[model samples]
Target chain A: MALKFLVVDDSVTMRRIVMNSLKQIGHENFVEAADGRDALIKLNSDDSINFIITDWNMPDVSGLELVKQVRANPKTANLPVLMVTTRGMKEDIIEALNAKVNNYIVKPFTPQVLREKIEQIISTVNV
Target chain B: MELTNSMEKLFEKLGDLKSFFIYGQKLIPTLQKILNFMQDTVPLLESVNKSIAESTSKIPKATNQLHSVSNATELATTEILDLVDGISNELNSIFSKTSELKNRLQKQKELAEKLKSKYQNDNEIDEFLSYSLFDDELCFVDASSNKIQESIMNITIALQVQDITAQQLASVNHLINSIQEKLSGLLLDLNGKERESDKSSSQHESITFNENARYVKDNQSQKLADSLVAQTNGVKSQKEIDQLFSNKNE
Candidate 1:
């Protein structure tokens, strides 16, 4: 099976752009959710989702909260999650790091940067 | 002598009290003026409150309109993105067809040259042999093809602005709703009612927004993000470090 990505964001435009960007970089398998709560539902239903690309500042549950839940559950504890967000401050980055995202990419990222980070994470992980 | 002194002192105090009563009578008009001033401001205060209530009522409408704008732009952006994707696919197909055309032209030229050698004086073979249908056409298309693909990619990249603007509008919406909630609370208080608990008028008001979101045309923020990710990805994360210390204590 191909690597299925669970992309979580509140904005429909963001989800489309992210999925499109992923397709541009040769990763076509994608599952999208509009918010963190919806992301958890998708994660629960699809055990095939190997990687997670999430955005922070979502409604209901935040990206940080979602990552914490993913980590807390042993079933998805070790899955590699990357945060793509508009938060560029050092403290926000540190907070995300503490939440244990494999890597971080700021918003308005080029496909090249996404490819670079995805390749980096794929190298270190089983996926 | 003591008795006379006490009587004189008492008389002096009585005179002072009589003078005070005279001044007190004079102060009544001034006191009435202040009372009249208070009565005059009662209507002005109500007018100010009415204005605040009216403005506060408009906030929800403003936020709704903002949401409408965000949705409209996102719809337009999605349509543009779909068109770009379709054009990119068509461009790829054009490139492959041009490559095939180039190959077919090469073979035709070779065949015509071979026939010319057999029939050196044949006019048709000579005409076919010298015919270069696309001498510089393929080369020019190939060069411009890259530029076109690049332009298409740029269009896709710039579409990120819609998402960025949506986030910005969301941030603004959150701000507006929060103000609305506060103004509602203030209005409630100004109407001489007991202050109620913190109940937000809009459910979205409670959701936090990313205030720092913006459309940065440059990659400077990404560079900083890259450096931070680099710094953190190398080592055990802060959570891991915390876990390690906790485990050691155990």
Candidate 2:
């Protein structure tokens, strides 16, 4: 079954890049959100969305906060989240880890890196 | 004669006593007023001393807060710089990817041209002209290749993201400059140093920030040229753009 992925980012270009990468990986079903709040709406509305890829810096609701909300919610508690962001600092990484993101990938990531992170997250969750 | 001498001496002594009593009478009320004034001033002086002690106690805390503000602003500035760096790195990646896409499209277009030339038959052209339904597959391939070139052009236009990000970072850089100047003024004020208004008021003092602003300004013109070129379907390669930036830096 094809996974329904929610790709969240404020930049349209970044979203397209992520979605294109996902498409290249054979995951064509995507629900794109402009930010965390939008992601939540999509997540709530769409039951088939099984995975999330989000950027860290967003207005109103950040990716970290979105992950926290996902973890807190009973419906999406165990859903896998991969934080793809430019916030590569150690503290940011720790914060994302503490937020319970399944995996993290820094920005300017090659498609291969993204694929690895996605695979790693999906595998970890499956385990 | 002894009575006369004694009486004279007693009169002299009486005169001196009269002088002393008169002086005491004059000084007693003034002395009392002075003592009362001292009594009133003692508590006031004590209160003043207590207020001074309290203010002195808070000095360290105020200084610590100023230090914290400075540290916080510095941290914010560092984070913004990191964000800017990340954005630049991302733009570079996107440029490379777009360049690769352009090359692929060019290759496809070249192949399509080669196929078109090889398959072009004068008899078939007459037939294609006669029947609208007799569409040559090569013609479709040529059109699709042109579409690919258009898509590549669009990608090149999206490189305007760099310009937008640069402008945003420039604004952030301006804000950081303002914060640093304000912090500098605050510190100087706290330390009782002479706050040089000339230096603090000018927002162009930080060499690093100024250089960044200048880069953004230069990129603005580049961004304009890039947009116009992209519109004309004449996009520069990533290597050429990099060279242009490096030349500007030099």
Candidate 3:
């Protein structure tokens, strides 16, 4: 079974690159959002999206806010989230963990790291 | 008695005028000094106001140039990505075609083996074997395909630098705009203009960005971030455990 992904980032370039990486890792089903605000709207509308990969520091509602919203809602609380971002600071990563991101990825990541993170999340969620 | 009262009234009036004259004498020099100070300070104030205006005027242009750089990089990145995607697609086509041919070649070799076993006396079957799809040829195609795919992924990874650098630039832009706003306020104060009440003040919030965003060539930060996350998950890293024991022993 193919897992659907919601790939969220403000950059069009990052969005395409993430989707391209996902495709390389053999997961083709994707929904793209330009920011966290759009990601929430898409989540509310789409039921099949099981995985979310988001970038922090977006324009309006950020990825952290979106993750918090996901955790607050009983419907999507258990869904897996992987934060792919350039914010690699210790405090930033800790803040994200407190926000309940399942795993974190710093950007400029190789395809292998990406695949490993995604698979790690899927496996952990499965367990 | 009436004459004495009139005399006292005249003296009183004269004394009041003498005091008034003395007060005027004292005030005249002070007033002149104030005028002199104003004459001396006017040009200095004017120069400051002019300096502020000049500085503030150039800021918008600097910001606009930064904006231009961001836009130019974004455009270039998009074009490069388009080409990279094309190349990736070509690699995909090559990979699929090679895999399909390999499968077909395997079927041919299997059929050839069956015929050889059926015809034991046919030694010519060995000579008739198809050497077209050699192992080395397929291996070369697979290896090259892997190498090209890796290169495409690396290009994609490198393009992430654009986004990182753009964020850093944005942080700078935000700072410059803030400085510009502060200077504009200072200019208004210096010019003695009433700050036009900003009707839209703080009513709508604009985007806030990470001020400390920066680009690093290598993502060594990830390893540290991962350890932090692991710790938060109640998983102790080996280094942390060792440090804890060493501290306890000490």
Candidate with the greatest DockQ versus the true structure: 1
lDDT digits (tens) for residues B1-250 of candidate 3? 9999999999999999999999999999999999999998999889989999899888877877776797799889999999999999999899899989989888888887888899977877676665644778899989989998888888998898888878877777777777777877899999889766432322212434566656665668889777765654533344553443343333
TM-score of 2: 0.41
Off by over 4 Å in 3: B1-45, B111-133, B197-208, B234-250
Interface RMSD of each: 4.0, 16.6, 5.4
lDDT, candidate 1, at B35 = 96
Task: DockQ for candidate 3, please give it.
Answer: 0.50
lDDT of each: 0.83, 0.61, 0.82
Candidate 1 vs 2: which has more DockQ: 1
In angstroms, give how far residue B69 of model 3 lies from its true place. 1.9
Residues B127-190 of candidate 1: C-alpha lDDT, one tens digit per residue: 6766756858898998898889888877877887877777788889887877877777789888
- Enumerate the candidates' DockQ scores in order: 0.56, 0.02, 0.50
TM-score of chain A of each: 0.98, 0.96, 0.97
Model 3 Cα displacement at B24 (Å)?
21
Q: Which pairs of residues collide in candidate 2?
A: none
Q: List the residue pairs that clash in candidate 1.
A: none
| Alpha carbon lDDT at B203, candidate 3 | 23
**Which has the better DockQ: candidate 1, or candidate 3?**
1
